[model samples]
Target: MADSDGEFHADDASDDLEDHRVTTSSKHDTRSRSRPEKAKKGTRKSGKAAWEDIQRSWDAVVEDADGSLTAAIEGRAEAEKRARLLRDTTPLQRGIIRHLVLVVDMSFAMLEKDMLPSRYELTIAYASQFVREYFEQNPISQLAVVGMRDGVAIRISDMSGNPAEHLEKLQGWVKQEPQGNPSLQNALEMCRGALFHTPSHGTREVVIIYGALMSSDPGDIHETITSLVHDRIRVSIVGLAAQVAICDELCTKTNGGDTSSYTIAIDEDHFRSLLLEVTTPPVTRTQEQSNASLLMMGFPSRTLAAGDSIHYCSCHNRPTKEGYKCTRCKSRVCRLPAECPGCGLTLILSTHLARSYHHLFPLRNWVDVPWAEAKRSKACYSCLTAFPEVPRTESGKGKTPEKGKGKNNSGSVPTPLKGLSESGRYACEVCRNHFCIDCDLFAHEVLHNCPGCQSDTRGAQRQNGKATSNGDANGAMEIDS
Candidate 1:
């Protein structure tokens, strides 16, 4: 009996030992699973801390930088970048000419002093600049001017390539005080008539610099907009004061419901920029426009003044010593870019022909290089002036100075150089050479040749061969090849 009791006690002890083993294994499994979770939590915390540090560093850098010119430069850079992207996607068709009419509002509203020195004066100033830039950018495009006042729209200047004539007419007209309401409808009708005579190969556009909030229309403007759309005429409006519903509707209908065709100018600079953008080639709307057509042009040589023979000019119908004679009909005229009074052929100056070539070969936008990335040259490539050091902030970091801050003790901003911001130093994309702003403008405008490009042997040879022929003392005419 004692041996059997001992055996039962041994069995119970073995069962209790097995149960302890199972409980210990379960606890070990739980601890192993929790180890991975803790490690993941620690990694996430470290990543968040690193990101916060980077953000703080970026904030400090921006805070220590100049804010005034930075915004303007950044804005312009972003706009240029965006424009390049759009240009890459959209291909421009060759031999596409434009006929543009500028309609200026000469109503009483233009006399308002909201735009500083009066809206009329400011408009004229920007308009003059726009005319010069337009001819520079779009050499083949023809321009005309119209004025609306006293409920009537009058043609100020005939369509011509010479911007000087347009400026003269505009200046003479502005001398009189602005009066009466603006008749936009009349202006549109007159412009349509002017553009209707142009060839179908060219795109017709009208730009209206309107100041008044209301337009005095003699007829239904909606019908006029539909007619313009049907005729493939694109109309753009630049409002000086406020946006009008009629202008918006006209732009929308003419541009195929694209609302971006209209814009309101915020300031003088913005206004000038927007006006210049209109000089870009417009995208052809029809497939039929792909076929090229010959346009009749006559290059008239300048005839020197031999003596006072009382020769009458066909354009002004007055006696003049020096006048241009049409190559086609040999008819005498007062100025160029005029239709020959005898043969009705298009007459243009030699400079007009030379300027048109720029559209085919446009100057590339200069690249803005960082001071560190720029070559260690002491002087500018074009101007040969010493490079100015980058302005530093209290934090020992480089900062661009504001525009007007570089004035002398006389409270006058410095001439010529003005003030150079960090973005002002531009490097030629082809030659990788740096130049100042004044040099860049002179190279593109006056010289019409990149200084770096002109230095190349091949470029010099080409320039010599195609050197811009001087305009005749009177004017030279162009004949379609």
Candidate 2:
């Protein structure tokens, strides 16, 4: 009600008090209205988004007290195995000369015992293994490690191609316990600062084995990520916990929208798998680097002249008897595949380049051998590991058949004489020889050269063009060698 002077007074109300307040019926109606909303909210917060993936293996399963797999978890293992079989093997130009910074989170969250021993201990163990695997896969690549704790980034080791130095650094931290919170921004900033001056020809990468759900960042993480992208640094993260939005966005954007760059480990074994996955050289991005850029590298040779005086090593200011003399600076280096301390020239062995070349033109995948022909084989052509005999089927064949007389495409011994293992066998298309599972994996993964193809004499005969027959007995008996 308005007064005569238009002043509103609390005492001059004509409305009933009951109309201004909620009655018992209104309270009941309000509860009734929010019931459906509450139910929907509960259903929406089902926590599916936090689910971590199980290891993609058939043997990765929970076992009962009797050592038998429970029926409930069998289907999950099969699903993971199916997922592993769907990987893409298409060839791409990957960066072999990589300089990577491995950042291991040393936050309090790492003390959790969900992982064996503890997350921190297991992570360090895996980190050591990752160092070895990284060098093994990327032989010419250099690696450094960074530890993040108490909102500070500390360098564990400097960028070096020697795995022993990195291992020694990791081994020294056995007594050091994890403490404080992880700072993603500080860690990224540190990695960026260290890798900023790397040569544009090689890949610059950051691999973080983060174990925390939340990061105690001092500043905007987005700014650090922008700097990384501008500097062409590829960021890869393997999380011990569920996915974090900031990490997802960081990896996705830095890797140019690839979701495979980030992963969350379900268990310790799965965590190892995820970390080892980073050992493989990442495919190079054209926009991030120039393809036509030229780089000069030195292949250091270990040579010493008689009565030559020993000189101090450039790598370490220590006296050395003999070392690889740098071609550019003429200073002695203690090791190969290192940047010369005096000249900054990339010093490496010719073998390292050959080791790195396999990734560029890898051997083709071999096909699985047929059961009928595989069972007749006696051993591997290379290793000669005896293969288990195939069981006789009830269709009436009971005895082991004689070895086949036919030779392989290499024009040597009959392939069936080579024993095939029980784990099944693979046949090389070019060599037409059977190899057991282990040998097959080695041929394709490590030893890119095929033994059968290398041992064949037809290639030598074709190169020499069948020597003309000599009338003399001594000349006729002369060997090609």
Candidate 3:
């Protein structure tokens, strides 16, 4: 291929390169051609499946990063929604007696490392908080925990009002490892069976902490949903991973086809928020329960077993040094806020009724006060907390018609807005008074009453002054105790 004078030729080198390229192409062709038809089809299908999984992961990570104030505004809106959910003061019949089933997904998917220390570990931690809050708010209610794993549902704990027992069972999971797939149908069926004995006057509900995207269901899930609906059972789902259509459909159908019954946790804090939201007792379905019914409950007296004496408990049949004695049946029980097994009578303290009382009459949500009006006030009306002053802008100094009163539009609905919070103050709709964030949250979430509206003294002071002038005596007024 080279010239006789030992000169290199470009044409000869080009021919060799083309031959090598053709050889490489043929090798690849033969390799692919050697595969059987079934193997080739499987490869194509698996490639698509893998691609779909990647797409889902991509979707999970891809969040809206629009470089605008939209995200902040939306975050405020979420806060507003929470306030509205917590602050409604309307009087309604609530479920005083309740039974809630917790359905947990224990599939191997929970072992994923996306969440710190693994999703399963964090889930148990969040569930511990949920159980604590559930019993704190629903002292008279019973709760059962059911776990779905290995294509079946297993009862982890029985229905009881004791938070300690549930917490102990959750602690028992440290030695166990998650395995297999979750069975949604089986979990629901087990919940339905366990809650079958729930009284008609009580609320029957299920809260699922689902982790896997797929459910290993053998039966028609719609049929199971139909049965749940017929039994007046409400279902709420807290999805730990990507959203699944079956879970959406299952929660919606069980809760009378309501869409709010299911929510996905974007992070750890959001997961805790969603889980605790279920702790508040759900409204009783009118057709299922009557609010006027008088249910009898026994106030058990706590007694201590003397030295060398063990009292037999009706609850666990175990001997304990101290137990509550049911006044009705004269039987010793292990715990209060429990039903007496001897006479089937509820044993609870009257103070426990206050746990659910605030729900019946929640405080109205406070609205944000805009900078103009908020600038007029130097301190909170309730707590007298100093409000940080906004640096007076040349524009703010200019006289402008105060149009932000529109922020105080209504007490019934919450509006996610920022113009109302230039000074970071919340205003009660009824009293039109500004309050700090801490006081606002405390009043709405805990106190459930507006201190200004409940204990205003200016009008009383004026009345006392007028009465003193007429009486021609000391300006002192006596308050009736």
Candidate 4:
């Protein structure tokens, strides 16, 4: 092409060199010789600049397994894509950024039936709306997600500015069942790998939506969270109906951040407000300071994951003198009643109760509760009892049931079940022995620790006969005759 704007030339390649010299002459010009000498020097500078441009472009096209591109590529591609996309859309000015947030939580604790459709469903619905609205306002802002399912880390969707694509990916990811168990540490690590490592420009964040459910080792996430905060990466947290105590600790230790917890809401407006508040774009420095102060002032009194009983009593309506605690449950109950509100047992009249409901519930009353009622309670399906309750005192105080009168405390002797008197053929999953339903589940959960998800190979041995051609030992097979 000819020199359209007189910035270049069709045949005057030397003129391009002249342009470079003019732009740089004041900074690097030295004693000049003849025209020919100057032209040769200009050519060398031109070749060096051209080489740099090629190297920069090449670095952009390659990326790693987790979808992070090199800085050279990541920076250029992001800029180029933004420019191209903006050509058809509105540009973001100051205070113009819209937040595209994706909150994910599939922790097992979320499966509790007390909440209709479950906590996991509520989280997904609100978070999905947040993603939708951000795209509606500023389509170019990036969205990302990570969560846990069955203890395995799940990357819901890679960070991307395309809302339609990101939403589609998240929907697909959510359809699959939770993997093993919930692990918040695994989810946060996945978020770190997805967000900060890449050459993402502008600001980035990873909001954690969770409750008292968490992993065994949250301290392990300290380095990643610290780095993100120091970098000025926002980590807004939504505490849901409940949240992990460590979440507040992590947020405070790094950024002195605030969290929001939504009590079960009966109205749509409340749900909308909770969603909007958590997903709002980052506030100014002064507002953030105010938020930090608010977080300090309104500290949550109930401990996160302090076991169900303490959590329940701490939030109960009747407030007692702060120190009047129950002796038997050690659950900080008022002195008005001799019975512990947690376990519904008579108080022992000691400074500290000898038993904690968690231990007593699992060890003594777990199987003792009728299966019908236990099914309605939020007990572990495998163990059929609520997990142990923890005490609030820092001194490691917890009580256990009395020795002689633990579960089924009545002094009267009881008879064993009448059904077990008759001999019945029931193969045990492990030992392959014939047993009733009562013993089968006990052996499966307690003795075998097997989840009963797979086949029981020992069924053949339980038959006590050779297999028939049709695989039915009851007929056409050699019985012991």
Candidate 5:
């Protein structure tokens, strides 16, 4: 019995040991699962912190990009404003009254779509603007339109001071499809015939808008050029494509070796600008004999169209109530500066006489001021833009150090104005007004009148036939009193 009792105790001991081992294994399993979950939570926290940092950095980058874009936009706006002001304020000169013929190319080459919306379309639009501007600027000047198509030149509109008539004819004729190669010689010959009847007192100018590189001629172009030169007729050609040899020769011969008379259009904008230049009066050739002739002009009065008792126009030789009656001949006419059909007297307007007087008194050219002199102003005299700052060298701050053995280093060295090379200025000799390079160019070319001079009463002195003693024949002005 004692032996059996001892065995039972041992069995119970074994069962207790097994239960202890099971409890230990269960605890180990739970600890292992909890450790893995804790590690995953730590990894998620690190990833979230990293994402927050990336988000902050992205926001900073966006802010910097916005600021840079805004600054660039503002800079461009200021530049455009400066350009606009320069264009609008430029003055115009009242040049001599001229008789001009505008020859446009309606050839197949003009239909090329190189200039956006075809060259023909662009030419037509520009030509219309040119006619309007020409008539508006030169109210007294007579303009005729000639179109070249299918190697034949024809008169689209007769010489007329009325812009409406010319514009109407141009728009109607220019819409047609381009035909064959342009005949430049035929166009010039047609212009010569129309200008032949014009009085010698007024200058005769032929402005050809040539598109084709080659010119189809019926006769020798050299002979035509010779005739034009002898007649004192100046021919200026504005080429649309590359330069042509014949057109260049024509301009040189007629203009007495002046190369500026012929210009090849660089772009659409340049083409329009060149055409507008033709409206200005041509400079008289100094080498040619000045056959100044006195022209007989009669100021005609406009007769009322109401209750016309069978009044007929001397020009059209047709019955018309709305017409001008010549003061000398007492004959009705359609327009001014026309030779009366009833009588051989020249009928003209008072404005025509005023326009011709500009040749007697021409405007003076402005001289360029050096950077050394221009740097005196902190801002541009005309535009008021801040003057460019001078660059600093490693040795000297803003001053250009003096060289040579006798240079004194003891005293305070003077600092030269910055941006001497970049900042260029112009001073009008007559008015003594300072201007930037852009303003200077605009004043000379487009405005033709100095803004400073215009502000003073001296501008009217030219019109009053009173010569300023301060100026020389070469347009140099004397020192200001």
Candidate 6:
């Protein structure tokens, strides 16, 4: 009986040992899996912190203009708190205002000796002085001139921050023989175009220095007046011996301001005051002048807030239908097998077409100050390099490069990046944006602000030697605005 009991105990001990081995093997497997998981968790935690830090650093710098300029990033929200403060606190003079000047009535009648020095000469002098004064007070407002004569309206120049340069172009335009028929319709149409093309921040106005000559296309004039009424553009007419019916009809129908028998002889102070009142907040216009009930509609005005998505479409009265729209000239085009149906431009269907194409290049996300100086210097957008090689015009005069001269030029075929089968693939560290190496190297060194950093790109190049100067304009570094 004792021998049988000892055998049973030995069997129990062996079963216990077997159970312990299974438990140890399970723990080993769990630990092996858990070790890798813990390591991965640590890595992710660090990465999250890094991303947060990057964002925080950017925000801090953006608050102040000195450090960096990432806040003007395309597709980013407006820094409203900052801008509001600027509007309120900045000690702007009462006369410090921007103006969009449009000269109307470029017809042959304007060449007649109706006003001092012939209406055309007086027009140029007074218009130029008004522009110079407005710019001297507020140099930041963009200026564009539209010459209306005959039956056609042509843009003398695009909206440019440097009105002086555009003024020079206007002078050149004046020297040319006047073409087209005398039509206020053309002038009004140009105003509509200017309103669409001009930046949303500035004030806009149309100054018609004419003898009120009626166009053969009177029907077109009525249609244009109706359109202007709806579009809410302030039309100021300076009549120099013009027909009473023409001036009265325009002033009454359009609800505009008409200076009858006036040839820049109105009280300067009163005129300035009138201009100031019109430019005041909730800017208004009226047929008959009064302190109350001034209707809105003025030039170079800030109707649209900053960062508002401006839809530039040739098709009037239609909301911007999405899909493919021409970036250049802002014309709407529907997709066909080939060709832009609206503008007849050859359509290259791709996401990068707008960015790569020079003419359709996106608007500047940030406001560049001292525009006259900037244009005079021909400051590069990347390096801010001014006075580079002078452009060879057909007339052999020095000129700056037109927008979009880099790789993937509007005229040239796009090439693939290194080992990549597409254009616009490289990245810049200083600019903190992607750009082709060719663009970076070309714009190295100058006062130009980076679209990414919004700071001088030269500093970025010096800090990081890894930054290649292949095509960057500022130290071969450019911020993609």
Top candidate (lDDT)? 3
Residue-level lDDT of model 5, residues 235-283, one tens digit each, is 9989989988888889999988999999998889788888987776666
lDDT of 4 by residue, 368-397 (tens): 332122223243433444422211222343
- Residue 133 of model 4: what lDDT? 62
Q: Could you tell me every candidate's TM-score relative to the true structure? A: 0.67, 0.72, 0.69, 0.36, 0.59, 0.35
lDDT of 3: 0.77
Q: In model 4, which regions exceed 4 Å deviation?
A: 1-101, 173-175, 197-201, 257-272, 284-481
Summarize candidate 1's per-residue lDDT along 273-384 as a digit string, tens digits: 7777787766676665677677778777778668656578887788887878888778898776677779888787767767766555567666565545544455688888
**What's the ranking of the predictions by TM-score, best on top?**
2, 3, 1, 5, 4, 6
Where does candidate 6 stray beyond 4 Å? Answer: 1-101, 114-116, 197-203, 253-481
Give the higher-TM-score candidate: 1 or 4.
1
User: In angstroms, how far off is 172's CA in candidate 1?
Assistant: 3.3
Which ranges of candidate 3 are over 4 A from the true structure?
Answer: 1-91, 301-312, 317-323, 370-384, 389-420, 430-434, 452-481
Question: Higher TM-score: candidate 1 or 3?
Answer: 3
Worst 10 residues of 3 by lDDT: 404-413
Q: Is candidate 5 or candidate 6 better by TM-score?
A: 5
Question: TM-score of model 1 relative to the true fold?
Answer: 0.67
lDDT score for residue 369 of model 3: 73
Models ranked on lDDT: 3, 2, 1, 5, 6, 4
